[model samples]
Target: MIDNPKIKTIENLLLNKRVRLVQPKNGYRVAIDSVLLAAAVPARTGDKVVDLGCGACAVCACIAKRVNGVELIGVERDPIMADMARQNMSANGFTGRIETNDLTNLPCTWETGQIDHVVANPPYMPANRAYLSPNTKRLTSCVEICASLADWIIVAQRCLRNRGTITLINRADRLNEILSTLNRGFGSIVVFPLFPKAGRDASRVLVQAVRSSRAPMRITSGLLLHEANGHYTSKAEAILRGAPINL
Candidate 1:
């Protein structure tokens, strides 16, 4: 049994309260990025989806609530966070799996080219570019300590079946680098930008691709998350409230 009573944790609701997750109170809480990452994935019933660097498993639990019949697995490097992930999954009644292993060295049970869909909200900053958080969990979650962007993409490429979908949300400034890494094996790529407001440049982007598809890359008209008045756009609210988005 997890000794969460001794851990600094908080309960947060997502998907309009359809799901609840326990996250570290101060270190690396669930944010809009994880929620948007879960929303960007287009998974159907019976699909097998794996979340890389799953943290407290918020993305997987959110996806499980939204997509019925889909199988979910969360891979997290930190054992404490992984244990918390398991607790959150059970608290939310999610039957999906959680693996406390580094994404670069996933267990053999996750066979190559078997996953139907893969989603990740990888560390947005390069390890050398920013000040590392003193909190270990936050540090690993925000920087490429355990895995690089290329490493995450490589693992996704190896795990996805032919034509399987892989989706990611990352810093918008790194779109070029993210695309270059995805080019190794992913195609039919689509980039969806997330603007902070109606006319602002995107702060984040959601990128989706097929494992072995040959379709041309495209950038869609992106999502404006907020209005000039500081309220969430209706569309953004719908998605945050668990409305399915077709990516």
Candidate 2:
């Protein structure tokens, strides 16, 4: 019933049933970032995972599909999204395991280095640009007025076990910045480039790293998401459909 396009929200299906996010309309809603971020790293059974800045719970839902039985905690700075995330998890039958929280409000048990994996697709913009939505919540989703990349890395590093993996997706041009952050906080880095189309410059990239891995960095075969005809590449389709991407 809402007609505001600038509202930040989405209606999606994760584990089958329909679900809604805190987003209203016309705002920065869920996009391919959710899929790309979830698929960037391999998940194992029983992993304790956290999704930083989990808007509408899309990434967390995607992760739940990839790694069953993992303990998932969805962190959202916005309270409305927190409620929506809880609904999304409930729709997916994970109301108990996939719950809402703010890192600042986390229980002492969860605040420590107890998580086995951390994933994020954080805001790409700086803060408060002319293009930012008038809706305060929508604006926060796309800009970093509240949390920064460094803050995310710090929280992830602290929450993860010694070698827990942290996976993220961001603009391709930000690769170096991401690499720098990961290198400073963790090791065993892996990078994947995601192109908008064949022969085009990569527009997005996925990066993963282990908390204290000693292995050398590996840049895997980059991914192409579309063909010149604007059709989804088979590789991209597979990933979007919850298929695994080889590291």
Candidate 3:
């Protein structure tokens, strides 16, 4: 249990109980998108991977479980979430550091071009366009406040090494915006959509790009998350159970 008097938290299982996650009880609980985002990252052993806006380190913990010996770092803007992320990493027997910093103003100590891969599940809604939540934490988690989607891409580009990969999961409607922002700095782009069910529209998309590469973009036959009866598809189940998926 979290010892903080201000924040009420609960322990939950992720990755078929392979990862134990501690998160706030009311605000922005860890979701399946976090697991899918973690699965999309193609990090290998010895790769230095950084997660931007890592609320409670869910992605970091999942990645740690999936890939052993990789260096993990997380940057979270909220202090409470950052503390929980550190605790979660420790509880999972993972070694990593959480930096409480705004994505727009990352610490100068983080050298440019040092990270092998950068992954982000950034806020899906634009601050001006979406309905704002009354709960501060939830609002920040769901809607962009201090940074825009472009800012996240810029930070990813800044941190990633040449030819390194950047992976992101966001609203499917934002594919155009995502691609436009990544156009000059990244290439070899892959857009993978996540359909809620067979013949249904995709609610989310996973986009991966390599910095400074010129390969053309490709869109895969996307994965369906559920059957018509609402059960998870076998492929989706395998991914949620800690299987690594190449984007």
Top-scoring candidate (TM-score): 3
lDDT tens readout by residue for model 3, 132-232: 99999999999999899999999999999999999999999999999999998899999999999988999999999999999999999978999999999
TM-score of 3: 0.98
Instruction: Compose the digit string of candidate 2's lDDT tens values, residues 51-162.
Output: 8888777877877777778778878766666766676677666643434555545665664788888988877776643376787766777777776766677788888888
Candidate 2 regions exceeding 4 Å error are: 1-10, 14-23, 96-110, 128-130
TM-score of 1: 0.96
**lDDT (10s digit) by residue, model 1, range 1-247:** 2247657778888889888888878887899778888988889899999998888898998898888888988888888888898998888888888888898887544658889999999999998897988988788888888778988988888889999999999999999998998888778999999999976899999999999888989999989999999999999999999986676
Off by over 4 Å in 1: 1-6, 107-109
Better of 1 and 2 by TM-score: 1
lDDT ranking, high to low: 3, 1, 2
Task: Report the number of backbone clashes for model 3.
Answer: 0
In model 3, how large is the Cα lDDT of residue 241? 98
Residue-level lDDT for 203 in candidate 1 = 94
Better of 2 and 3 by lDDT: 3
